[model samples]
Target: MGLLCYGSVGGVMASLILVFSVMWVGGVGGVGFHERGSVMKWSGIPTALSLFAFCYSGHSVYPTIYASMADKTKFSRVLFVSFAVCTINYGVMAVVGYLMFGQATKSQVTLNLPVENMSSKIAIYTTLINPLAKYALIITPLVNAIEEWLQVSKSRFIGILIRTVILISTVIIALTVPYFGYVVALTGSFLSSSATMVLPSLCYLKIFKSSRRWGLELVMILAILVVGVFIAVIGTYVSMKQIVSSL
Candidate 1:
């Protein structure tokens, strides 16, 4: 776990450096920060919102992380720090990527990188490794749930087999689907939004119903819930429409 975190951080930093370098090292094989993109494209907003939701997809494993923390009171602080660091990292990457590639930027920024540059190569390799490093951590909770449901939690062989099957299934799905961007958007809209925004708010309201009244906090949570539902519905609809049309 420690090594995974360290390697991911290094990969992220390396990618960021490579992106920044692209701004100066122009004309090698990729576009420079020269294209002036439009102010806003309202048509793309739904997909963009879904992708943004994907950035906070860690909600599923958050409970496990909080439970494992020895210092329970500091969970909020830890979550805040984590979100802040991630937001800064993601925001910087998004801005740098847009500035570097502008209109030519593909959904996958690595694809727009100068293929021959050493920095680009480093960034590409690190980006590949970073996700692989996180795959287990992100899905472990789900895997554990499956094991328990199947009454195989105590069976080492069964657990390994289940994990292997899941891995293979995911790999096959990834390879089979050409519309991964749409799929990601759907996952974010349908799952991440529910987990991060809808579920948390509902859980809070349910648990605190006895003590809480119709006050500002209740209104705030309800507002969040409405926003979550809107994003989920609209984002999912747009992404699904695109996927169906492309097919």
Candidate 2:
């Protein structure tokens, strides 16, 4: 479980760095230090900062890890080690990606990179690893939903049936929508906000009685909620526009 969790987090961090780097160089304005062609609009530094913050928000996984720990006494030590490892891994990848892409590290960096180049290997790995990781992630939620349904009805057969149905539905959707990234992004943004921000704050408030410091936490939670909403709204709008324009 630890290894899987580490790999999952590490892979995600590497993939995100590549994604943001590609976006930055592709005029997405996140990491582009060069002030070229109206960087004042969506291309500004604020957008870049937001993108970085979003990427670093992977730290939200710590609470889940801590919660699942059998030995709570070693929780802090475990977290420190895990975080250090993840940070080092992420930092190395980000640096390499930045160096490899130089100025053109936009969102689709992998597609633009030469397959013959060594850096392109990272792109390939990112492409392959991300979907597998996403599959694992989606399955967890699906399985939990099935388990809950079964528990509520005390019917193991019903759980199995529901699981089968979900698996079939997923396959059908995957086949119907050749582009699954949009689906993943939509679900990720919504769930990430809830799991990482709102739920954590609530848990802290309830467990620790941090009402005095709750103001700041509440503000941060609200910010995350707003960002999640922004991502969802803008993503939907842009996708719709693209589909319309293409038609």
Model number with the top lDDT = 1
* Per-residue lDDT over 65-181 for candidate 1, one digit per residue giving the tens place of the 0 to 100 score: 776667789989988987887787778767777877786778787887777887677667766776675777677788988998998999999999999999999899888988777
lDDT of each: 0.78, 0.54
lDDT of 2 at 100: 51
Regions more than 4 Å wrong, model 2: 1-68, 74-108, 118-126, 152-168, 178-185, 188-191, 198-247
Candidate 1 has its poorest 10 consecutive residues by lDDT at 20-29
lDDT of 2 by residue, 1-247 (tens): 4545666775667666565544444343333333333324453333333333344455444555566667879987876876676576557654545555545545444654556544455656767677666454446555655577657447777767776887789778878764333344444444544455556656665787565365876677557657655654554454444345545
**Which 10-residue window of candidate 2 scores lowest in summed lDDT?**
30-39
TM-score of each: 0.87, 0.53
